[model samples]
Structure formats: C-alpha cells, structure tokens
Target: MAVTCCSVCAIQQLVSPYSAELSNGMQMAFLFALFTSAFCREAAKECRRRKKEYIKCLESRVAVLEVQNKKLIEELETLKDICSSKTD
Candidate 1:
C-alpha cells in the first residue's frame, strides 16, 4: 500500500509539476489511486450511516416490544379480574 501510494505521488508529481506527460497506463493508475483515496474517505461516513440505520432499527423494535408487553400485561390483569369475580 505504501509503495502504491508513493508511486502514485510520484506519478502525480510527474504529471502536474514536472510537465512530463504520462502514458495511458500511468494516467489510469493515477486516476484509480485518486478514486480509491476518495472512496476510503467516504468509507468511514458509510460506516456511520450503517450504524445509524442499525440503531434506528433497534429502537423501533424496542418500541414495538414495549407496546406489546403493555398489551400483554393488560390482558393478564383482565384475566385475573375475571378469575377473581368467578371465585366470588
């Protein structure tokens, strides 16, 4: 990776500063390096994006579970009341 980075930097210098034109292959390598670097920078943001999505999903699930639990508790209390009245 370091070697590739160094080579890319060298190629960039050659193309930009030294007024030396690169061959088609070298130009392609340089463009690939630039794109790879850009993607690497965006990769961290992508990770954060996925994390946020996962957290949102978890929170929504939790909310749904909480509501379901409340409904179940209410049903259980109603059953208890009915059972007590039957005994009376």
Candidate 2:
C-alpha cells in the first residue's frame, strides 16, 4: 500500500548515499597506504647508504692512526740507540 511504497523509497535514499560514501573512503585509504609504504622504503635505503659511508670514514681514520703509531715507535728506537752510545 502507500505505507509500503514510502518505506521502500526511504530505504533507497539512505542506502545509496551510504554506499557512495563507503566507496570514497576505501579509495582514500588505499592511496594513503601506497604513499606510506613508498616513504618507508626510501627512508630505509637512505639509512643504509649513510651507514656505509660512516664505516668507510672510520676505516680510513684507523689506518692513519696505525701509520702514525709505527713512525713514533721507530723514532723512539733511534733515540734509545743514541742515548745508549752516549752513555758508553
């Protein structure tokens, strides 16, 4: 009857808008997830690159210090020989 028809119309109006809103929300969520994943990947790559550079710098510094220590030992030995000769 007229009551049935009115109820059907009301249901259609409410359901249609809700369906469209749900579809739009899903699309936005998908886009956000995609962008966030990309950002995280790029950040990880940058961190690895910086870590490699830091390791290289540290190795070079250690090599220089080792060279300096060897030169100091040689100089100390020469000074010791000179002092011993003077004492004799």
Candidate 3:
C-alpha cells in the first residue's frame, strides 16, 4: 500500500484541529498526575512519622508496666513471710 503526498495532506487537514485539542488534554493529564504523586508522597511521609511516635509511646508503656509488676511481686512476698512468722 502506497500513500502519496495528496493523501497525506488531506489527512493532516482533517486531523489538525483535533490534534491541538488532544495535545491540550494530554498536558492537563500530565499536570494532574504530578500533583497526585506529590500528595501521596507527603501522606506517606506523615504516616511514617506517626508510626515512629506510636512505637516510642508503646515502648515506654512497657517499661512502666514492668516496674509496677516487680513492685507488686515484692510486696506480696513480704506479706506472706509476715503471716507465716505471726502464725509460728
């Protein structure tokens, strides 16, 4: 199949108007994708920061509970020894 100059020119004439409109639509789509990617990056950064803070908070809570547990066990042992001595 061979397309000559006349057919090429006729095709361009028919398509030129729609080609400009298509170019503008593609430009708009590119800008929208850029903005969406930036927004998602910032959101991911914030999520990472919040997760770090939450882990630190839980670590501190675990330390506090461990101390409380040791204190209660010591007090229970003291009471048991006192009761046994008084009975003897």
Candidate 4:
C-alpha cells in the first residue's frame, strides 16, 4: 500500500507540471495571435492611406492632361487656319 501511494504521488507530480506547461503554452499562443492581429490591422490602415494618396495624385494628373488636351486642340485649330490662308 505504501509503494502504491508513492507511485501515485510521483505520477501526480509529473502530470501537474505537464498541465502547467500546457497552460503556459496556450497563454503564449494567445498573446502571439493578439499581437499579430494588431499588426495586420495597422498594415491595412496604412495601405488604405496610401491608396487614398494615390487616387488624389491620379486625379491631379488627369486634370493636367485634360488641360493639355484642350491646349493641343486650340493649337491644331490655329494651324488649320494658317494652312487654309496659305492655300488661298
């Protein structure tokens, strides 16, 4: 009976530490997941900010191109008048 008691105590001791280690591992995994989620959220916010800036830049470029096209059209009209006068 004494030997059985000693074996049971030894088994309990071993199992207790294994359970504690498993709990600690789960805690560490939870923390890692929390931090990774935060990092991804911040990355997504930055990408959105950059995309907004890119859209604004593209809008400005389009406006400038429209002005340039108008100027080209005006210059073409003037050239056409000059050519017609020369022909006359």
Candidate 5:
C-alpha cells in the first residue's frame, strides 16, 4: 500500500483506483507489473555494464592501431630516403 519509489508509487496509484472492482485480478496484475519493473531495472544495469566493456575494447583497439600506423609511416619515410640516395 505504501510504496517508497516514485515510479512504483505511481503504479500503485493507477492500480489502486481499480482495486475494488477487480479484486483478485487487480492483485495479480499488480504483482506482474512489479515483477516486470524489477526485471527491466536489472536488464538496464546489465546493458550499461556491457556497453562500458565494449567501449574499453574499442579504445584498446584504437591505441594498438595508432601504434601500428606510426611504425608504418616511419618505414615509408626510411624507404623514400633510401630510394633518393640510390637515385643521386
């Protein structure tokens, strides 16, 4: 009857209005709504956790690619110098 969370309180208010008429049906519906709310809360937390891990993986890959790109650029410059010396 006394719900602390604003969201849950709102749900209870919505359900309470119909409680007298619905009786057992209202109780079942309220329980189902609560279960769904808790499940969604947990699912959202899990999604955030997975998103953070994916971002970390992408950052690591970007760092590795940057290092490899620098090495390739240096090698290209070295080859250019060698070619110019042979031509001279």
Candidate 6:
C-alpha cells in the first residue's frame, strides 16, 4: 500500500524490521497498536482546531444577534409609548 502521510511512513519504517522478527499475530497486534495511537493523536489535533473555529463563528453570531436584539427592544419601547399615549 502507498504511504499516505509522514505518520504512516514513520510507522512502516519503525515496524518493518521489528515485525519481521515477530509471528503473524504479533505483527498484526503491533501494527494495530501503533496505527491506533497515531490516528488518535491526529484526531484530537483536528478536533481542537475545528473547535477553535467553531467558537469564533459562534462569537461573531452572538455579536450580530446582540445588535439585532437591541434594535428590536428600541422598537418595542417606541410601540409601548405610542400605545400608552393613545390610551390616555
């Protein structure tokens, strides 16, 4: 199989010689452990990056909503004042 990334290439290099000395089952187990740990490390890094982006997006959205809310409240107060004057 083609090496997809630096991590895969590193794993293959690290395991090739050691794997040659092991039984088939041991080779599979060793490969699985190495690959799983690498994948977990990559996934966590990706999650953290995406989480930062999501937080920035949410903060911008909140800022916009706050502005809209303030405008709506002003409109509401104007309407209330008009209604009270008409009733009086």
Best-matching candidate per lDDT: 6
Backbone clash pairs for candidate 1 read none
Best by TM-score: 5
List ranges where model 5 is wrong by over 4 Å.
1-22
Error of 3 at 83 (Å): 1.9
Model 2: CA > 4 A from native: 1-22
Could you tell me the C-alpha RMSD of candidate 4 in Å?
15.7
- Residue pairs in collision within model 2: none
Whole-model lDDT, model 5: 0.83
- TM-score per model over all chains: 0.59, 0.65, 0.70, 0.73, 0.74, 0.71
User: Residue 6: error of model 3 in Å?
Assistant: 48
Q: Which segments of candidate 1 are over 4 A away from where they belong?
A: 1-15, 18-37
Residue 43 of model 5: what lDDT? 86
Ten residues in sequence with the least summed lDDT for candidate 6: 1-10
The local distance difference test score of model 6 is 0.86
- Of 5 and 6, the candidate ahead on TM-score is 5
Evaluate candidate 2 by giving its C-alpha RMSD to the native, one decimal.
Answer: 16.0
Q: Could you give the candidate ranking by TM-score, starting with the highest?
A: 5, 4, 6, 3, 2, 1
Which run of 10 residues does model 4 get worst, by summed lDDT? 1-10
Write one digit per residue (lDDT tens) for candidate 5, span 14-76. Answer: 778778878787677876788688778878999999999999999999999999999999999
User: Which residue pairs collide, candidate 6?
Assistant: none
**Local distance difference test, each candidate:** 0.79, 0.74, 0.76, 0.75, 0.83, 0.86
On a 0 to 100 scale, what is the lDDT of residue 32 in model 6? 80
lDDT of 1 by residue, 1-88 (tens): 2436876676566567533566778777877777678668678788999999999999999999999999999999999999999999
Candidate 6 total steric clashes: 0
lDDT of 4 by residue, 1-88 (tens): 1235755465556456556556767755654565566668878999999999999999999999999999999999999999999999
